[model samples]
Target: MDVSDILASQISKHKSILVEKDVPLDTDVGFLTVTDPSVVDKESYDHDREAYLQSTARDGIQHLLAALFSLPTLPSPEGPLAQLPPPTTQLPRAKPLPKPKPPTKWQRFARAKGISSQRRDKKIWDDERQAWVPRWGWRGKNRDEETQWLHEVPANADADHDPSKEARVARKERTAKNERQRLQNVARAQQGRTTATATGTQVDRKRDINRTLATTRMSTASMGKFDRVLDGEKKLRGVKRKFDPIEKSVDAEKSANLALIKQIGNGAPGGSSLKKVKRDGLDSESGGNGGAGGVVNVRKAVRFASGGQGAAALARKSVVGSGSDGRQKRRGKR
Candidate 1:
């Protein structure tokens, strides 16, 4: 036979048994009493009772399945398997614990009488000090005598005490004086003025001069004309003027250029006139020299040439006109 036919026959058998036993269809079999009058012995009754109870428990589960699956009656043992309710899709949410309320006087009293509410591990008894000390650690207890002395506070110590009125007034005066002095120093520096020393004594100018003379030993033998004059020394004749190396070199060049011009003026080539010689000399002197000194020398040489007005004009023109040539050369390059 097919599987469905077999299942149908088995179910029909179970239904027939249930009907012959005369069991109530709607009663919860698990709670039903044994009403059989033929049962006499207690053992037999108990045996029957246990069997019935087991059967009823099984039937109760089957009935629950039938109801959940929308069946008209209880499922037989051999009936097609029915699905169980999707086991508690989610667990019931737990409620939060209520907040603790503050202790009443009675609670506090109870706690004082050896019923501690707070954790007791924070403090412990210190054997050496004979005191209740913190569990974490103690500070400064094992320190040396010197360290204990340094850490000690005086009996009369008052950190927040105000100063006396007289002390406050004196401090204000001192601060004001310091501020005024600072402002005066700033003003002097801005205006390029020298500040005097704190003692207010006049500086000894003569003393400073005496000190310089002693240290430097400046005397008439090593002095210039200006220095000698300041020192009240008698002026002497034919004492070649003292000049720096640069000035000495410039003087030598000027003398050489003058000699060259004099030679050129005295002996010119056949066709070249005195004016032409003078012009040539000036041009050579100016070209060889540079700076304001060259322009001065050119003018001096021209005046000495005896060419009069024309020579002076030519000297002026040469000095001024050279700038235009330099500018024109720069423009041409661009």
Candidate 2:
């Protein structure tokens, strides 16, 4: 009744699913990849390239699938599904590490002076307040005099001189200076790949700072009219107002303009026409107004020559010479 011989014949007809190698195949079922470290059979590969490649791929796939199936299966709606384990193989990062930020001007100075930075607490202890107050900003310890109700006036102080008012003014000035410095630092940082050791490049930095100062000055309320007057700053000059003759009628004005145009077009006493002279004058006045006939942009040329300071400043600079005193004065003015 036993069919052991028949069963043995059927089993022998099929190839075994198991695969063995010199080096054990590494399987990462999560990634569905198998690392075959064993050397390939050169003789078999050379004999049949396609067959060799197919067989190699087949072995890797079989190893990956076998590892996946070994995992414990959970019940699912359609069928049991085995969960893949986390990948063991380490992969390189797709992106490169970020570069370090360029150091600020203060940082460079600190480095040169061999000064190490120490963390300072934002809050400072006040003996009068009997509580911690901020070092700066929002009822800060720096504004102790300004916020206090009572103040002791000095014997030498003027009757109108209020210590509280003076203190408030001084605090405002201090804050403004700090903000200006911060803006200057930002402008310098924007200049690409600067080294801490360079001295010749400071003029370029000062140029940026001067522009920033001008922009911030206009940014204040009343278009910087009410803001503190900077030292050596030019006084506000009123524009000369002009008006056409009120006695002349519209018809007369049009006729007069036409007559003038006709006179100019008829040419001057010299051989050349007055119209050419007028056109030349206009072109000269246009400066860098993007006129097609403009050979050289006067504004850009002046800016480049004076290192961002206008023609008037350049004239003053030439007159004053390159002495440290004059240079320092120009910097302070900006």
Candidate 3:
């Protein structure tokens, strides 16, 4: 018998899914996105809606697969994987480009003098120390004279003059001068940034001055409270506060109530306070298992009276059994 013809007929029934569009699908291989600009057939879509939707989806998938298979593939353990090319689309940045930092005072001076800035190593050779030492910090070559015990006094020096004290003062002054210049540079850069408009510049300058003044006031012995108050000075503000704790959990309250019920059931001390609990069973949750005079649970009492038959079956025995939706009626006739 020729069963090959039957098998061939079965196989030919499902041909490759063909995608036909007016403008063709815009395929981005990098992002694996396909945009179809063709208009849908409303008559075909409205009639046989489910089949139409399935056909449309099948077309899209067929087009995507065709595009993917066209690309070169690399061999993998599972199968050959297509290598996606770089994206051709340019995307905008999430945030605006940051402003460049303003040049420092020394940087500007160096530029004016046509001097290229060069960074030197932190450690330097010292003649007196006879070893590699820091250029300008603790025990540095610059501070050798300040730490030296012996000093050659000048020819016309005062009797009470101290060489060590003089060296220390000079070092401190140099450091203070450097710090002052650094602060001035920072202030100048800020001023340049804030000077977008004349009125805005004045407002920013005043705000900066007030902030500096406030800092000085807070640095006082009494924290500006006992210090002499200047006219029109605004009071300092602290973080918002409250007496009670935030985000109190309900679980603790539930546990407390359960414990109280259990305690009263056990007949604990201080009976007067728990008088209400003893009198009433509170609710069905109590199950009437509290105190000497406990009200029985209604459901349990009914079950016992009916000899193990549930409430519903016992109820149906007397009257005509009613349907859950109340559609059933008297069964006297039909």
TM-score of each candidate structure, all chains considered together: 0.14, 0.34, 0.34
Predicted candidate 1 versus true structure: per-residue lDDT over 136-200, tens digit per residue: 43443322222332344556758854334334466557668877866765664544333445223
The candidate 3 region of ten consecutive residues with least summed lDDT is 325-334
**Which lDDT values do the candidates have, in the order given?**
0.52, 0.78, 0.75
Show pairs that collide, candidate 1: none
Q: Candidate 2, which ten residues in sequence have the lowest lDDT sum?
A: 325-334
How well does candidate 3 match the true structure in TM-score terms?
Answer: 0.34
> Cα RMSD (Å) per model?
33.5, 28.1, 26.9
Q: For model 2, which pairs clash?
A: none
- Candidate 3 lDDT, 39-90, residue by residue in tens: 8899999999999988877777789888888899999999999999876555
Better of 1 and 3 by lDDT: 3
After aligning candidate 3 to the native by TM-score, how far in Å is the CA of 92 from where it should be? 5.1
- Predicted candidate 2 versus true structure: per-residue lDDT over 1-334, tens digit per residue: 8899999999999977788777899887877889898888899899999999999889888877878888999999999989888878778879998977768788899999999999899999999779998998887888888878889899999979899999999989988998998888887776555545444577788979977877777787788889889799975444589987788988999998898788777644454567678767666645434454566555576677678977778767766775445533443343
